[model samples]
Target: MILPVISDIHGNLSALERVLEKIDSDRILCCGDIVGYYTQPNECIGKLRQLKAISVTGNHDLACVTGDVHGFNPYAKEAMDWTKKVIKDRNIEFLRNLKRKIQIKINDVNIMMVHGSPRDPISEYIFPSTSDSTLKSFLESENADILIMGHTHTPFIRKFGDKLVFNPGSIGQPRDGDSRASFACLDVPANEVKIYRIKYDIDKVVTAIGDEKLPSFLGERLYDGI
Candidate 1:
């Protein structure tokens, strides 16, 4: 089976829709932050639900449900406050129900997924610059053939001995200096994962953010992919 892995959607339905159009998979795995930083939180959640995505809770997802935006920047806090006021009850419950991490087996390959790190699933950031020793420790302790995580919004595939760790990047808001939406496809039989970047309607998302009166910087950043 081909498994599509995605994360950090951040509520941009335009980007998510475009990414979905390119994927052909029976199941989708999400690393979380399904909502935040953009408009259309409900629509985004609805789409993921339709896909029956297996998702983990993200920091923003938890913040939206619990009204705890601590450590959030001014812009993020503003967006979260608006999200809390406008998000539907059912969708908030969905976020609250998500786990911080999950594990599954596909085609005999053991995979562990989390929004952040193995240590702190919901709020940590694992960048490509992280040391090999630290990553080796995580892989050793987790005991999975493959580890998947998202939060840094940068796509990468790394290998250590026979094990692998990868990030599918952000679908809505990419920070890898690439404006395209990002995702990864795991070929279960082959035990390989490949990253994909797709162009989407950013103008539509930016316009929606303005219509919703969200922070302008949020939309501006999408253009630069910063």
Candidate 2:
């Protein structure tokens, strides 16, 4: 089966719609943060639910439903506060029930999906700059052939020994200096993984953010992909 993996949607409805339109797959694995830091929270949630995406919970998602915004930055906290007021009750319930981690089998391969690292699934960042030693440490403890994580908002596929760790980056916000929506495709039968950087109209999302009275810089970040 070919599964599309997406993460950190952060509530950009335009980007999500574009990404879904471009990809044709059997299933989608979402690494969570379906809402946060942007506009159109309700729409994004509805789309994901409609698509029936296999997903896990993220820190931002946690903050929204649990009201535990303790670790969020000022900007994220602000957006989340606004999000709390705007999303529908059913969408909040959707977030409220998301699992922290998901363990599943895809084409005979054991796979684990989390919003962050397996050890610290909701907040710890696993980035490209993460040390080899740290990756090795996680590898030693992992039981799955593939570990899918998000939170760094950077797309990367890396190997630590025989274990593979992949992040599809941010769908709503890309901090990798590319103003593009990112996602990954995992071909289980063929054992192939692909990262896709998709271009969407940033102005659509930017205009919405500005109209919602979100921080101007948040709108600007979409243009710059900062």
Candidate 3:
């Protein structure tokens, strides 16, 4: 099976659409934060539902449901408040019901998916800067051949012995200093992961943010992927 892995799509439907259009896969795995940064939360949620993506709940998604934006930065809190106000009732339920972690086997490869680290599935970050000892600990703890995660909005693929841990980055708000949308394709039969970056209509997203009266920095950061 070929699966497209995506995450951190904080409601920029244009970016999500572009990423989906380029990938051909049997199923899509999302690492969450489906809604919380931009203006099209409902639309993004609708698209994911249409695709039947296997997803985990992100910290932002949880905040939207609980109406608690504690620990979020000022900009994220503002967006979360707006998301709670604008998101449809059913979509809110979808986010509310998402799992914090999921384990699945595809073609005999045991895979684990989470929005953040397995230790703190909804909130912890596993960045490229993370020490090998820590990453190895996560892999050892899960006993998964491949551990897939998001939340850092930075794409990376790391290998420890035969085991792997990867982040597909942020489809909507990439912060790896790349302005393009990020995703990954897992080829189950071959046990290989390929990362891809696709350019979308940043101007359109920015214009929509402006139209929605969202924070200007939310739109501005997309151009630089910061």
Candidate 4:
């Protein structure tokens, strides 16, 4: 089975639409952060709902839906507050009801999905630079053949023993100095993972941010991918 996984879509509907259009897969799994940062929170939520994705609760999603922006950075906090006010009731409810982690068995491989590390799940930041011991502990705790996560907005794939940990990167906001949308396709039958980067109209998203009067920094970061 070919599963296309996406994550960290911070309310950039245009980018999400483009990514969805380009990916062809049987199932869509989102790692969370469905709403935050960018404009069009309602539209993004609508599109995600239409796709019927199995989603986990991202920190931004939780903050926006629950009106608890304290955990976010200043810029993120400000943007999330604006998004919370602008998001529709249905969308907010959707986010409020999302799970923090999802475990699925596909083709005899145990796949665990979370917004961050399995240990802390929604709040941890697990990156490439993260300690190997920490990653090992997380895998041991989850005991999954494959672990997928997103949070730092950087794409990565790490293998510890026979298990694999992968991050498909951020769809809306990529901090890896690349404005392109990042995603991953897991070929369960082949036991292979492929990372993909697709270019979209960043200028269009930037324009939409301005039109929506979202955080000014959001528009500026698209070009720099910060």
Candidate 5:
């Protein structure tokens, strides 16, 4: 099975649209943050629902759907508030119902998917610099041959023993100093993974944010990827 995995899509429907256009896969798996940071919360949710992807909720999704902005950063809190006001009721319910993690078996390979670390799936930031011991602990606990996650917006594939951990980065708001959409595809049968970066019209997305009156920094960061 060829599965396309995307995560950290904090709104930015245009970027998500672009990424989807480039993926030709049988299934879609999302690591969440479906709503946050940018405008078009409802539209993004609508598209995700249409695709019926297997989605795991990220911290931003929890904050926006549950109206729990207190734990979010200043800018994230603002975006959550804005998203809460604009997201449709159905979308809110969808986010609320999303799983924090999912496990599936393909071609005898145990695959675990989460928005963050397996230990604390919803909020932990797992990046390339993360210690090997930390990765080992999650791998042992999850007991999966392959682990897939996204939260740090940096894509990488790490191997520990016979286990593999992969992060597909951020689809909407990349923070790896790149203003491009990032994702990954797993050829499960072949046990091969390919990371992909696709460029989109960042200016158009920025203009949409301006027209929608979202936080200016949200629009500005798209250019710098800060």
Candidate 6:
């Protein structure tokens, strides 16, 4: 089975649409943060709901539901604040019910998907430069063949012993300095993972951000993916 994995998202429906259009898998695995940092929160949520993407709760999703974005930086907090005001109750309900972690078993392969790390799903970040033990922490309890996570908005695939650690980066607001929507594809039986950086209409998202009156930084950063 080939599974398409998407993460971050951050409420940019244009990026999401572009990424989805490029994906050819039957089922999509979403690593959370479906809303926040941009406009079209409802539209992103609606698309995810329509696709029935398997997802985990992201920090932004929790913040939107709890209305507590105290730890987020100024720009992120501003977007969260704006998101909470305009998002519909149904979308809020969706965020409220998101899972913290999701585990899937295909044939003999076991896959664990989380927004951050398996230890702390919603807040922890798994970076490319993380220590070995830190990476091992995610696979300590569950013996998953593949561990998929996202939060840092940087894409990388690392092999820690037998576990394949994957982060598909961000769909909406990428911080990798590439300015392209990031996603990944996982082939189950073959035990292979492929990453993709997609190009989209940055102007659409930027215009929406301006029209929505979100923080200027959010709109400006979309062009550079930072």
Q: What lDDT does each candidate get? A: 0.91, 0.88, 0.91, 0.85, 0.87, 0.89
Badly placed stretches (over 4 Å) of model 5 are: none
- Candidates in order, TM-scores: namely 0.97, 0.95, 0.98, 0.95, 0.96, 0.96
Query: How far off is residue 226 in model 1, in Å?
Result: 0.6
lDDT, candidate 4, 83-104, per-residue tens: 8778888888899899988999
Ranking by lDDT: 3, 1, 6, 2, 5, 4
Give me the overall lDDT of model 3. Answer: 0.91
Model 3 stretches with alpha carbons more than 4 Å out: none
lDDT of 3 by residue, 1-226 (tens): 7889999999999999999899887589999999998999999999999989999999999999999887999999998988888999999889988999999987688899999899999889889899989988888899889999899999999987678889998999999999999999987777778899999999999998889888899999999999
Collision pairs in model 5:
none
- Candidate 6 displacement at residue 138 in angstroms: 1.9
In candidate 2, what residue range of length 10 has the lowest lDDT sum?
A: 134-143
The backbone clash count of each candidate, in order, is: 0, 0, 0, 0, 0, 0
lDDT of 1: 0.91
lDDT of 6 by residue, 119-199 (tens): 888898888898877777667676888999999999998876557888999999889899999999988877778899989
RMSD of 3: 0.9
Question: How big is the positional error of residue 133 in model 4, measured in Å on the Cα after superposition?
Answer: 2.3
What candidate 6 gets wrong by more than 4 Å, as runs, is none
35, model 1: CA deviation in Å? 0.5
